[model samples]
Target: MSPTLQNEALQSRAEALGQSLPPLLAEAEMLAATLMLGEHGRRRAGSGDEFWQYRAAHQGDPARAIDWRRSARSDGHFIREREWQAAQSVTLWVDPAKSMAFSGGRERPPKGDRARLLALALAVLLLRGGERVGLAGLAQPRSGRSQIVRLAARLAGEPEAGDYGAPETAGMVGHGRAVFVSDFLGPIEPVEAALSRAADRGVRGALCQILDPAEEEFPFDGRVIFESMSGSMRHETQQAGELRSRYLARLAERKDRLSELARAVGWQFSTFHTGAPAQSALLWLYRALEGGR
Candidate 1:
């Protein structure tokens, strides 16, 4: 493409993103608000009202360690703990590969958009819960709600070169979790490899497979021409209906393999369709993190 055409394309993309972002952010915040009302609140030990436990005051116990009411009833003085002290860091990665740009219908959002929304919403929830959030291969895990807008901006921007597939785990050094949001439609080897490396580093996390409704249902009929996002492959089917069964079978096989890989690495795996409510995926992710797997 010529430079002028490239600029026009970029401008068009920017405009589309601007139109879509407000709704996405609003929906995400609404979902987060609902989740906050439930038990999905922060589980980490921090400044909170909920009671965790009480233990015998030790030698290094601070002067404020005594719980007056509880200590009065007990022979030994005890210190109260709200919860675990360390706040977890979660690294999120949404596949920005060309394939994610495909949408089955005009009404449906692209898989990439859905993935970005989920990643951002999940980040919102995590930040609210006092956990650090970071974008895999892009940003370092950091705390505070301010990072949310920065993440949103990066998601709307064009993908950088080599920004494809699962993220690299080399920079994830702590015992933090990693969340991978993607279609996971490509070969399984790279996914497996990336999860393996993170597992080796003691980073447990979850995998969310975002798919278009048509992709999951294979709702095509009659004639159809399928072209690869990279334009490297093409297939034409005269009876698209006839291929549905085979396509579905292959998709199921892929999901099964992904599940097995996730299990092997002690990570959780779940699937979400763009047509479904985003809250469901966010809830599942929040629970998975709470489960501390």
Candidate 2:
């Protein structure tokens, strides 16, 4: 596509993304709040204004290290220790390829929407916990709510380019975490190569495979015309149900390979279906970051 046309397409997509933000943002916040009520609530250590704990004054302590008021209450002086100031940067990517546009039915949201929603919602949770978040292949990692807003805008506005697969991360630096949200239905070799590259940079992250219920269930019967999203392949079958067993087996094999790849690199892998609540995936994602597994 020409640059001007690409720009226009990006703007149009961004506008469409913007229209969905209010609801998505609200849902994300709600999920975060719900998770916070449980034992897995937001726990982050950073050099922020929040007080972490108080420790006894140690040798070589600066004259100003003592808490005078606390000293007055006890013979020993105490020094307040604030939370760790350093924030970890997390780069996120959601495949926006044509395949992601598939929803299987008119009543369901596209796989791309689910991927984008999970990516943004995870960003919200991370930002709230004082971590830097960025959209992989789109923007640099940044912290605070502003970063979330900027990411949402970018996600909404950018038109997907390139074939369906992993987003390039060659320009990214640091050993911090990364999150890839996608249907992951593409060929395995390229995906493995991309992830291997990221691992070479000391980057460890999670792979979240988001798929439509139909994709998982293969709930079709009678004659069906299966079309490829990239318009490169198509298959017409008189007995669609007959393909279900083989389809599911291939999917299982794909997921198994992906899981093995992640394990070999000491990363994490997860799968989410659109029919389920998004919060479950978001919560799992948050915990994965915490455990680094």
> What TM-score would every model get versus the actual structure?
0.80, 0.78
Q: How many backbone clashes does candidate 1 have?
A: 0
Candidate 2 minimal-lDDT segment of 10 residues? 37-46
Q: Which candidate is the best by lDDT?
A: 1
Candidate 2: RMSD to truth: 5.0
TM-score, candidate 2, is 0.78
Residues 55-82, candidate 1: write the lDDT tens digits.
7889987968679788899788988878
* C-alpha lDDT values of all predictions: 0.81, 0.79
User: Between which residue pairs do clashes occur in model 2?
Assistant: 14-156, 14-157, 46-84, 47-84, 47-85
lDDT of 2 by residue, 59-120 (tens): 99997967788788988989876665567788888887888888877877788887788788
Instruction: Give lDDT: candidate 1, residue 283.
Output: 86
- Candidate number with greatest TM-score: 1
Model 1 residue 222 CA deviation (Å) reads: 2.8
